[model samples]
Target: MQNVTIVICNYNYGRFLAKAIDSALEQDYPATQVLVIDDGSTDGSREIIESYGGRVKALYKQNGGQVSAYNDAVNMLETEFVILLDSDDLLYGHAVSNVMRVFESGNFVKVQFRLDVIDPAGKPSGTYVPHSAAPSDCGSPLRQGWLYPSPPASGNAYRTSALKKIFPVPEADINRYGADFYAIYGVALLGAVATIPESLGAYRVHRTENSGIDFANSESNDKAPKALTKRWAILRQMARARLGIELPLSFHDFSLEKAHFCSAVYQAPFTKRWRWVSRQSHSYFRSIVGNPFWSYKKKIGTLALSSLCLLPFSALSDFAVRYIANPLARRRF
Candidate 1:
């Protein structure tokens, strides 16, 4: 392992803070430094962090959000690689050792791996496979750039030099929430990125985990416009800085996302296909229908309207899904 530094950026996650730090420090790989950048936590996090004493390097700052944490922590360390571990997540024991195996490659900014999805109690519920292939089993030489099911923050180990282009991430409204998108896309823009085929970390699913525009669903309310505005700003930055194209972005529409998913379901065999329909139907139910983000009326209205996609009529199904579900989803956003 090449003198890796795990920057466990945290905020108000005192409940799981120590576990995150311990996982990093307990890695079998030697020469691993654990740096906890606490963003003005009020939940007794300071005490737990302080308990580690000099065993872990700690930094305290006002509630400036995640971008600041990474921006500050990266500048403070000169290590070759930095893992941005979330305070609520855990690094699999072999994470550092696993990621380092592929570091010697050239023209790559980072290596993204898989993470296990765990419950709040820390029991593994399911594996977060970035693709059907395993992390170690994935990533051919030419496989790079904008990987699908994008790797979670914890599963990534970034080349510090490559990060120089991404840091001080925009300082915009959206970036204030977190820098994962900017960092990942920015690095992808800087150079090629690879993937590992192992589940190297844990991503927690809890209420505290559900905020920001990424999780924006039916409940987002008027804030959706703000989120979208910031999103456009971030997208503009990525396009200009990375692609050198004068293009900007907007929430043009997501009818295509729904259309593509529905189209795939339409082509599958009925037995297998219903599963796809049910999954997305339930997804609409959960993300919009049962979503806490939506208003009671909007939730019911969206659900009642989107359910038309399940009708036996194909044209009606396609029209309802392509036009109704997606438009309602955006309005709910």
Candidate 2:
């Protein structure tokens, strides 16, 4: 059996599918199998995968969305490690090799690498995005505390046995959110995780992409308002499911920021709206109180920032950049 199984979930990204496949086929690691699962794309994506011939194992299925494709691929993996690569993304020259080398140390439950966001023209845009690597045995995956917001599974590698236990990827149940958050959270619940500092891949950001680009479209004015409602509801659900306690306003605010961003970008709700802006602001302040793990100093600072969120006057200032801010910015102000 191969040491690593690479799974690419293809949708309508015909233009970039070939490059993604080529990158997988060119992996420096030995004993690797590339599996391309096409989710019923009419955009010539299947043709691109077919052109690769024996270079990849292609599986064509109905247009069941990304989560469904991921569940299908995860079930089929027979290798020791599994990596998820989106069709529009590219792996660095030594990505597979770097991951293999790290695995040699034998100290991780899962490892997530860095991601570089690229423009439509395929030029490097000088943006270096990084996740907090998996939190090193961070306490209580279910608590109202802080944890790395789950790394992107795109360049992530998981031990086969470790992943099978969490399989089925919950495709049918997830509405707007993808699988990574649930996957990483489950991994943390299972064991320790590690982060690789080297950036081993590029995640393409363009107008055709669903998340970032769709939110900016002209007709989505009510998008923000509806998303705010959905986000709060999801957070309550997540908190209840994971920690069994309804998170206070502060935690709700912190969690809502993430969910809101996902809905706007990934779910693409229509027309930006802000009816729940005041309520969200209150939740933001309430999240900081009594939360464990966050240092008292940090909590105090967050409380002050949450105060800003509470003010009716600060909505425009905060709401304008709320969805786009990174984790630190969101918590800090």
Candidate 3:
């Protein structure tokens, strides 16, 4: 059996830490190794990690955010494959086994699966991430500067060799929060990715004072576009340096445009929201029309949904903003 390591990174999430660790330890695969890294938590997180004893390899480090933990985890990984589990999320008992099956069947750099969204209380939210499977052929869209649909960190498994080339990601401010973005996009640039169309894990979503869960909030919506824009630039640079492929200078993804639209609609004053939404709607129309990878059905569906934003009435525009533009609002809990 191929050795696989589950690196669960924690930072003051002691409330939800044990369940994450237990999920890793309870994987059906015997060769699975569970490594829990505590990023300088003050809330008895280290104690929770230590309780696992020899069942898990526990490493405690000063608080350095998610990417830093990823760097530390990658440095110590000796397994053939690794899954970076968020301290708050979980893996199904067969997650490793399912991922191994895909890896054995193909020459893939990364294996991505769906994630069932859960509340902090661990109740089902009746939603799954990505809303669709990742395309088998990512090269075409990637070269066109479009990032295909992918789940968050816990929903991915990476080949150690591919990860070794991708990390240690630059410990810059922009690269701090979303380590999975770098891992997923970077590995796609390296080689092929296998997609498992079933949910193999659970992604916990909760609202804290600082949580970015509220997609309708202007600040949260604004940050996504900037982050995604910067993320594409960084990935483009990596592709040139590592793969010698020069990506298009302009990046266009429906998700990024959605973020911009959401931010503008929510942030703009009432009198100006219509104008801003109209502008973003035009951008969306252009994006949908220009994307060669999208099928006519998808393009028409997207274009039709975005056109609702240009409606003169706030009620209709608000409905479009909530259901169509904001991804989080589409979820039914």
Please list the Cα RMSD from the true structure of every candidate, rounded to 1 decimal place. 10.8, 6.9, 3.0
Q: Who is ahead in lDDT, 1 or 2?
A: 1
Order of the predicted models by TM-score, top scorer first: 3, 2, 1
Candidate 2 lDDT tens digits, 1-333: 248888998888898888888888888887778999998999988778877788889889998876678778878988878788888788886888888777767666677788776666566655545533445573254344344544356767787776666555444443333555445655554566667887888877553223232322112434544544543355446546754555434223344443353343322222222334443334444445544435677678655543343244544335433434333223333
Write model 3 residue lDDT over 149-174, tens digit each, in one string: 78888999999998988788778876
What's the true lDDT of residue 19 in model 1?
Answer: 96
User: Once superposed on the true structure, which residue ranges of model 1 sit more than 4 Å away at CA?
Assistant: 132-147, 208-229, 238-308, 312-333
Residue 16's C-alpha lDDT in candidate 3? 93
Error of 3 at 197 (Å): 1.0
TM-score for all models, in order of appearance: 0.67, 0.71, 0.90
Candidate maximizing lDDT: 3
lDDT tens digits by residue: candidate 1, 1-333: 479999999999999999999999999889899899999999999999999989999999999877778788878877988899999999988888877877875545788888776667897754463433322312221122112335667878888987876676656445576467566655655566677777888888553211211222112323544553564467556557755633334322222233334444432444444566566544334445333223687656656655554556665445444333222222322
After superposition, which runs of candidate 3 have C-alpha atoms over 4 Å from their true positions?
207-219, 267-274, 277-282, 290-295, 326-328, 331-333
Q: Estimate candidate 2's RMSD in Å.
A: 6.9
Among all windows of 10 consecutive residues in model 3, the one with the lowest summed lDDT is 209-218
